[model samples]
Target: MAKKYVDINTLKYLLYDVYQLEEVLNQDRCEDHDISSMNLILDSVKDFSDRELYPYLKEMDEQPAHYKDGGVEVHKQVGVMMKQGGEMGFISGPFDYEEGGLQLPMMLYTASSFIQEAANNHLTGYIGLTLGAAELIINFGSQELKDIYVPKMLSGDWGGTMCLTEPQAGSSLSDITTKAIPQSDGSYKISGQKIFISGGDHQYADNIVHLVLARIEGAPAGTKGISLFVVPKKRPDEEGNLVSNDVTTVADFQKMGQRGYCTTHLGFGDAGECQGFLVGEANKGLKYMFLMMNGARIAVGRGGAAIATAAYHASLEYAKERPQGRKLASTGKKDPEEGQTFIINHPDVRRMLLFQKTVSEGSLGLVLLASKYYDLKHTLTDEKEKEKYGLLLELIIPMVKTYPSEMGAQSVSNGLQVLGGYGFCTDFILQQYHRDIRIFSIYEGTTGIQSQDLLGRKLLLENGKALQLLTEEIKQTINSALKYDDLKKYAGKLGDKLQEASKVIQHLIGFAKKGDYERFLSDATPFMEYLSTITLSWIWLEMAVNAKNALVTGKKTYSEEFYESKIHAMKFYFKYELPKTNGLAEVLLNEEVLTIAGEKEVFN
Candidate 1:
């Protein structure tokens, strides 16, 4: 089978036609960019990823980062690739030109990242965190801090990590015990341990910058007292020479996948010498970190979509090339000479492939849509427009983060199944893709955490205005799609889903109003699952309508099969995936809370 990254045609259609990215580019913030330049940037990244990253993906996975001689040793290729990415300016693709960036629109950057991540996620992740780290400094750091740290990080001369997870504290960051003491020179001495810090300790860069959250002495307890700090692995001395800052690597974690990058247990101020500079205000660390977290969460979603896309294409290639059992339609035939039929001709294999297609592409569209909202939220001058887009982004962030992650895992599994026994073997990358994407749902925030955010907070924020705004957006899509003969059915189905979801949410709100908050959120996970399905349904309908319009109006530049495939996948999603919401809604509407409400003795 041929090696693949992603379907370029579908991406072009989504960006240029469905999403109308050209319109976005015309906006003041993105007016400087156009399709041609964005395409060139994307092509460059793809070419580099194909040549440098894809070939070394297996090597990186096989050669996991190791703890040797008091330092982490990753595949040497990782350093080379990081430098390659840095030189290509991908590390600062969305930043301003003055910052040595291309200032590409986020939509274009998301698409570019999709291709690169599809080619090799483990390697791409090394720089992904660096971009986020740099963005934090740009958004909230002092001018000096930004001037010093952001440039090197953007250049990939220095690596970056978000240090939040500790030995005792995982997702509940309020429990973090990392301490930062004020020093005489306007710096703080950071002392604590952080675990699962990816790319934490490596020789890929000249230095590593850690965006750590620590508490100052005499501060209040919990997350309210946490402060953000920029702690570098090596700090400059009085002569401006980089020296060891007392940051130590206690250990490296061995994971099931993404072995190319290092996840380290780091100890700060073991020698009582580690120093850090505060970012933004003290005790506002969580607030500042969340700025990075939201973007990282969406990036995780894109990662999930990218890996799933690679799996789908690989399996699709395998199915077409690898001859297997006869199609079920040929059951009564006795043509022995005909031999085995291609597995793609079989309905079951097609089902699996379509599922992968709908999940991967639909999730990709959802993420890009959220990114558009993010752009408008930041760049729009009108306060009302910014506020509207802000609420829209807040509501969809969890879905855009978790839906692709959880569903992409399932899609990859289906892709693996499509390849039969060969997928489990090392001859193919399916198993690796499967392994790497498992961390998508687990990291960023678990599906459970996202579900709670979606239900407990997003739904109730501003007295339910966020949810109303989201529904209105969905309604607009429905209204636009309702007139299309080919899309009306899916549009109507999506409308029903919105109504059903609204009712379930209202029912949950009733419990909350009565102060039964725990019970109100008891089935939040399932509710999130249902909402994700509806959101994707809306996306599929929107895409189908766009495809239908292109084909009917002769506006499509691709072959007929290209447009048909979009509609086919949309139908597959509506017929097979969207209906699952009914059962989820049923569970949400029911009052029986067996998991949390039942007696503990019942389990035994």
Candidate 2:
């Protein structure tokens, strides 16, 4: 059978060897789950996605959600998929058992989510919003608030959205003009227009819960004045029944991709005062939102990675089946006598396949590793270990979010190139994959935003503690590799790259501390790229080490071809991929490459 998604062998290697997800199941915090249980859950999720969700993918994108007669209408097929997903308890996987969740570890949950996302990206948005909402309420909302809303969201009886953007306040939250008037009761009346609110107003659920950021009356100005509110489409009565809350939809944005989800323009308190309850403390909206944003950001990155994996698989399948040309080395004229061979025989096609393999599998390996850190942060009982993993997560979050996103989009575009004209046409799936993956860099946060966050906040503000933790972890991995004969050479090269990356980061830190903001910001993207490349290289090396152990131990059954392919992927990344760091480091050290001083006309 043709492979429609990520290769199963690659998935097995990633889950067992690289991530060691089974080890996580044994952790005390994950006592609720064992490997068997987790595998069962994953199997169910994979089946649902393959059978129910994958079939509707093209139809959702082609038909899209449309706004008419005052309500946005999502495709009925998407609604069915979401309802089935909810029935399977996927939307609530990370929630507490008391709140209708499966009480699964975040690692297992995120791993399952990646399969669903790869199978169908458009429909995953609904689940994403639900998870985001559940997280926010569980973290900061009042007990009453959690009691009232958490279960409904988890069950998909209701949908949720984060309403932070306004017409004037795109990236600058401090400039928002949304007003919140304090009422005689403790609640406030929220009045404002919010744009780009994903899943803001959809018919998939009975009601929509908007986690809005607005300024309360008499509150201080700037971001400090902003507060988060749980504003629902309808107010629940004494009987806990929902009624119109006066929040109305003004319009829905017509977007370029991921059109299955509703992106609405919302007007709060238009018909009557929209009642809202505060979440957490006043003036700390951004901090609270960051909790949700951080999770969502990583999720978006994984989504991008998943799409790239799908596109690569699709292109590979097409290349293997479609007969096109002959081997370049063959001088035999017109193989018409022998019949045309498959495109896979062409060296150029092989090159494209290798490119897609490295980026897609490399991204999958990297993101899953990041999710493992998430599991450690939550599941580790040792305070020191938790803090250590937390620091590492902070340092790598930008890369995990930006690197896969940026590279995933590149991989999908290149996958299209491998297909030639068919890739450009709507008849093939690659065109839609290209359009879908393009949104990754923009959502969660822009690539530039992630770059600035890495250099400005993660690197500089922490005084290099996070980077130090990461270096120690990589060094430990390298030290372990010394015991393995097959991995020693690869580990040695990675060690050298680690040293180079660290020196560059240290120099940039010193430069920034000396008030060289221009020099510091100028090298930000290169620094980010260098760090990301090195991190992924380190992960690929770790996988290589594990593959060697698998071959030597003979503890499991696998073909020689599988291990050989794994080695090839590792070697390909190091040989063809790691050299980019040289250019990146050069860009950082030399001030000439800084584009800030370039003319505006040059930009044009």
Separately for all candidates shown, the number of backbone clashes (residues 3 or more apart, or on different chains) is 0, 0
RMSD of each: 1.5, 2.1
Clashing pairs in 1: none
TM per prediction: 0.97, 0.96
User: 171-275 in candidate 2: lDDT tens per residue?
Assistant: 889999888887887898988889988888877788888899999999898988999999999879999889898888888887777878778999999865689
Report the lDDT tens digits of candidate 1 across residue range 151-268.
8888888988899999998989999999999988899988999999998988888899999999998789999999999999998777978999999999999999999878999999
Cα displacement (angstroms), candidate 2, residue 477, comes to 2.8
How does each model score on lDDT? 0.87, 0.82
